[model samples]
Target: MERAAEAAREGNAQYFLNLGDDELIKLCQKRDEDGRSLLHSAVVGGNMHLVQLLVERCGNERINSQDSEGWTPLTSAVSCGFEEIVKYLLSLGADPNSTNAQNRTPLHYAASKGRVPIIKLLIEAGAKTNTKDIAGWLPLHRAASAGRAEALRELLLHTSKPLINARDISGSTPLLLAASGGHQAAAVLLAAKGADVEAEDKDGQTPLGAAAPHGQLRDALVALATGEKTLDDFEN
Candidate 1:
């Protein structure tokens, strides 16, 4: 196990790869002060070949395995913008819905980064649109809050109705997050899906109040304020 770690540090790729799966498995199990797998190091090093070798040999049962930080291989790929690796992990049946320590799924990461292709692929491959993270913010809220217009639009196609006004831990709805982030297009979509323009957060801030500071978002806020949609329409 120590040898593998040394090999990794010394950049001895062949020595590390030549180690048997049983030996590698033991090393993979070994954790740093903060837990991270050989897979984590492999991915972090951008060694796609090594990642594939590890996946094929060690097995794909825990393809989405997390380190001490609760980040999966898929999450890491999304964070690093490794689109090819992301697709390969999904093909290996990685659980898209699995959250890390932060309770954020791959969809949230993809949406937050505006990785439109990754977002589309994840949704098509069965990622849930409305799953909440640690913050209780849905994928929609993350996308809208990050101003990921295309990702939000792509996500909408999968669900006819995805709790548009679902509140997070802070009692801020998707509309509120989008408005606060000055995401005009996202605010409009949330409104069309029946988000309450008048909904308030713990601080008594409505979506309009959140968006008032942004010139582009103000128009969307005004439109939603005038629309007939109400929170009652979305009540479960």
Candidate 2:
């Protein structure tokens, strides 16, 4: 299996092709000692051609089949922000909500990377915005914590009525996460969406309090101070 993977990495398309359907099935079905498959190899290679071929031969259910790390082929594609590969996987009915060992969905990957197109694609496909990971962090929480302004915007546009003030298991709302990360744009957006800038968590830290120490949070502070209108009002 490592040899086949190395072959793919070295661009030995012919060797991969010659591995035979029977052999390919064996490898794709036979989890390595590491629990990885030939499909996993194709995904790691990010070879769109190989991925398509693997899908055509192995089918979509196998496309999501995971290795030891619980990473599906779609997970690999999204992690690298491979837009077309992700699209193809989704077209084949790949599970948008599938979580790895960390409990992160593909939306989380796109949000964390600030990949707008992929983020939009996932949202349009009905990816849940509020899915929690092992850390109880949702895609919104990740976008806020990572300061991914564009990702947050795409999400807001899609989820017009999203729980802007919904707290994670840590009791941190999107506003608090954004402010804590010093993401002015995200914080402002959250506040404008009716995030309770003054809402305190178990620790008694408001979004405003979270932003207090960060100079970059000034615009967000002002937005929170003055943004009294409901976030839903801004929806088109």
Candidate 3:
């Protein structure tokens, strides 16, 4: 099994390709202590050939199979920025909305990590933008918290105004999350897209109030909040 794992890692396609289907299935079904299948290893290792070979042999169920952490091969690909691998997996019927132990989807990881390309692939694959994780945080919240502007822009386009302003369990809206995290660009973008800058969280903290810490270009954000200026106007 270790040798097979190494073969997958090293892109030794012929080694596995030569094995009979029965032998291959037996080899692929073996999991590590964490319950991660050979498919998981292929994805994580970024070996597209091995991934294709394994998925073709192992079939759809195995391709979408989750490990103990509930992460599918698609999840691993998204996390690792393996765009081509992610595309191939989705094309082969891998679930785009697969969640992990935290109930976070591949979209959540793509948004949080600023994977603009991956974000496109996931959303086009029909990944839901509003799906909340254990913390009641959506992909928007994750993108804002991470200060991912381009990814945030893509999300803003597809999300409705209300969901753009939607609050998480801790009462942090995307704007508040962006501001508090010192993401000036993201906060402005959220505000321009109809997020209420004055909307308070459960703790009565608004985006402006939360942004008090970073103190970056305060006037610009304040002007944006009050409708005196829009982020788009600034660029124009």
Which pairs of residues have clashing backbones in candidate 3? none
lDDT string, candidate 3, 60-148, tens digits: 67878888999988998999999999999999888888889999999999999999999998889999998899998999999999999
Per-candidate RMSD vs. true structure? Answer: 5.3, 3.2, 1.7
- lDDT per residue, candidate 2, 107-151, as tens digits? 988988899999877777778777788887778788888988778
lDDT per model vs. reference: 0.76, 0.77, 0.86
210 in model 1: Cα distance from truth in Å?
1.7
Candidate 3: where is the Cα deviation over 4 Å? Answer: none
Q: How well does model 3 score by local distance difference test? A: 0.86
Residue 67's lDDT in candidate 2: 76
Ranking by lDDT: 3, 2, 1
The whole-model C-alpha lDDT of candidate 2 against the native structure comes to 0.77
lDDT of 1 by residue, 55-172 (tens): 7777776677787879887888877777888888889988888888888888888988888888877887889887788889887788888988777777767755737778888889
Candidates' TM-scores?
Answer: 0.81, 0.88, 0.93
User: Could you tell me the TM-score of candidate 2?
Assistant: 0.88
Q: What is residue 78's positional error in candidate 2, in angstroms? A: 0.5
Residue pairs whose backbone atoms clash in candidate 2:
none
**2 versus 3: better lDDT goes to:** 3
Indicate the worst ten consecutive residues by lDDT in candidate 3.
212-221
